[model samples]
Target: MDTENCTNLYLQVCQTFLTCKYDDPTTFDDLYKLLPWLRQSLTCCVCANVIVDPMSSTQSHCQHFVCGKCKGGKMILRPQCSWCKDAEVFETNQHLVVLVMCFKKICQLIASSPIYEHILNYDQQRKKELAAMKSDSPAKSDTPSKRKRPQRKFARTYVTSSLLNIPVQQVLQDAMNLKDVDINTQPPTVECKT
Candidate 1:
C-alpha cells in the first residue's frame, strides 16, 4: 500500500476500533449513525445491498456500481449497467475497493455479531421516546429556563490494547522492524484445492 493511503486507512481503522463498545448491544447502530457515508459508499446500485466485490460500469455517464453477484449473473451475456441499462463493460473501482478493504472487517463484525431482533426493538423504542418527547414539550412561548433539554448519552467503554486481531504491542514491534521490510514485494499467498 502507498504510505499516504496506508496512513489514512490506519486512522480510519483506529477510529472504528476506538468507537466500538464491545459490551454495548447498540454499538452497531451507534457506529452506523456515526459514519453516515459508509452505507451509501458500499451499497450496490442494483441489489440495494453492500457490495462485496465492487465493479463500476464503463460508460462515462454511468459510473454506478453493481456487486459481483449482480454483474456475474449477466456475465453469461455481457454485463449490463444497472443504472443506465447500457450494455457496458465493467472494471474494478479502485476507490471503492480501498474503502471496502479498510472497513470490511469492522463492518462485518458489527453487521453479523449483533442480534437482529435487539436492533429492531431498540429502534422502535427510540422512536416512541422521541415521539413522546415532542408531544409532551411545552410551546416555544415558554421561557428557555422553563424548557428542559435532553441529556446526551455516551456508550459504556472499556480499555484494551488490541487493534482488531493484532495486539498494540505487536504492532509497535512490527513498526520498528519495518526498515528491514520491502514495500514493493507482495506477501506470500496460499493456494487452495478442491
Candidate 2:
C-alpha cells in the first residue's frame, strides 16, 4: 500500500477497533504486528498515553498514543496532509506526509464522522466554521462534545503573603523598585490634636 493510504488505513482501522471495544482483552497482542517503520512514524504526534486496544483480524499500528479526537487535541484524521490539517488526498510523493495506522478504529470513525470544514492558515474561516458547529442545534450532534477539563487551577503563584491584599500596581511597583508617594499621612507622622 502507498504511504498515504497505508497510514490512513492503519489509523482508520485503529479507530474502529478502539471505539467498539468490550470489557475484554481478546485481540490485544495483534496490535504489535504492524510494520516497524509505521510504528515509529506516528508515536509523537499524540500528546498523551492511553490503553492499548485489541484488534481482531485487522492489523493495528499504534496502540499507546491517545486519540486526539477523543482527547484534548480534537478529532483530526490520520494521514493528515503535511500541508493541510485534514486533507484526505492519497499522494505519497509529499515529503512532509507521515503514514500511520491505528489499532483501534477511533481514528476511522472520527475521520468519517461529519465535522467542520478544515482550512489551512485561514483563521477567520476556521473560527467561523467552529462557531457555526458549536451553535448548531444539539439535535445535529452525532458526536459527543466532552472537552478535556482544564488543568489544576491552584498551581504556584507570585502573589506572596506580603502582597496578598495589596493593590496590583503597588505589588508591581515594589517588584520593580518603583517608588510611590503615600497620600494617607501629613509629612511623615503627626500627633493627634487634642
Candidate 3:
C-alpha cells in the first residue's frame, strides 16, 4: 500500500486506541493488541525519537518520516526529499498532528486533576526557592556594580462594548484594520498614593 493510505490507516487506528472505553481496569497489553503499529510507526526519521509533536512531513518518493527540524534543515540545503531526491513539495501529515494534539489534551487533563495537585505545588515551590537563592548570591567582580535598570512590563488591554460605547464585534473589526497603531503613543496614566 502507498504511504498516504498507510498513514490514514494509522490515523484511524490511533483514534480508535485513544477513544477506547476502559470498563474494567486493564493493562497496556489490551491497548497494544488494539493498535499494534502505534509504537513502530510514530517515530522520527532523523532523531529516531517518538514523534510526540506529530507535525511531520512525508517526502513524496522516499516516504520517510521526516520530523519538522530535519525537514527544515534539509530544505535549506536542497529542496528535495532526503531519501529519494524527489523535488516535489512534501505532503503534511495532518492525521498525525490531530492525534498528537488529542494525546496532549489527554495528558493535560490527567496532570491538572486533584490527585496531582500536591506534586504541582511542590514543583512550583522548588522553582521559587531556586530563584530566591540565585538572586541572593553576591557579585564576584571587584569592579563597582552598575545600577540595574527597572524593566517595563507591557500588558494587553481587552476592551468591552460597554467600556468603548460601541458594539464589541465592530470594535474588534476596526482594531483588526488598524494594525499599525503607533507604539510611541502612551496609555493614559492615573496617579495613586500607596
Candidate 4:
C-alpha cells in the first residue's frame, strides 16, 4: 500500500483496536495480549482515519483531531466540527502531527501484522451483525406478532369528588389576599408570660 493508504489502514486498525478495548474487553484483552500498546495513542474521532496532520477548531472544548477530508466535508455542510460541533476555525496541531509522523513507520509495521487483520475482520463482522439487526427489525415490525390485546376486567371510570368543593371565587379571594399581605407590616403573634 501507498504511504497515505498505509497511514489510513493503520488509523483504522488502531481505532478498531481501541473500540474493542473499551466495548468488548475480552476481545480487547485478547488483542492486547497480541499487541499491548495498541490503544495508547489517538486517532481521528470522526472517520477513524489517521490524523497525520491534526486539526482542531477549539482546543479547550473539542480537543480531538480530525483528518483533512472529514473536516472539509463537514465544512461544506456547516462550519462546525462533526465530533465537537465547534466552529471551523481550525489550527494545525504541530505537536500531534510531529508525533504521528514519527510513529508512521511503527504504524505501518503494525498494519502489516496479523493482529491488524484480525481487528479488521472483527470490525467487518460487527458491521454485518448491525446491518442484519436493522434489517431483521423492520421485517419483524412488518409481520406483526398475533398478540391479543388484554381486555380490562373493570372499565376505567374517572369520578370527581364533591367532598371538598370550594367556590372558584373563594379561591381567587384567598389568592388576592395573599398578594396584599406583607410580612413587614404584620405584628408578631407571640405573647410573653411575664
What TM-score goes with each of the models?
A: 0.39, 0.20, 0.33, 0.34
**Where in model 3 is the C-alpha error above 4 Å?**
1-28, 34-36, 52-59, 72-92, 105-194
For model 4 the TM-score comes to 0.34
| Candidate 2 residue spans exceeding 4 A from truth | 19-22, 35-37, 40-194
| Comparison by TM-score, 2 against 3, better one | 3
Residue 78's lDDT in candidate 2: 41
Model 3 alpha-carbon miss at residue 128, Å: 40
Give the residue spans of candidate 4 off by over 4 A. 1-52, 57-90, 102-106, 139-194
RMSD of 4: 28.8
Q: Compared with the true structure, what per-residue lDDT tens digits does model 2 show for residues 1-194?
A: 23354466466445534553333333322322222223333322332122111111112332223232323232232433233233222112221122221222233332333310111122354357768988994775668668957663222121122223232222222223312223232322346888
lDDT of 3 by residue, 47-137 (tens): 4433433334344345445444455333211233455344233444555555444433433433443323433444466468878998999
Tens digit of per-residue lDDT, candidate 1, span 132-159: 9999998675446766787523211110
lDDT accuracy of residue 81 in candidate 1 = 33
C-alpha lDDT score of every prediction, in listed order? 0.46, 0.30, 0.40, 0.42
In model 3, what lDDT does residue 192 have? Answer: 86
What is the descending TM-score order?
1, 4, 3, 2
Query: Least lDDT summed over 10 consecutive residues: which range in candidate 1?
Result: 154-163
- What is the Cα-based TM-score of model 2? 0.20
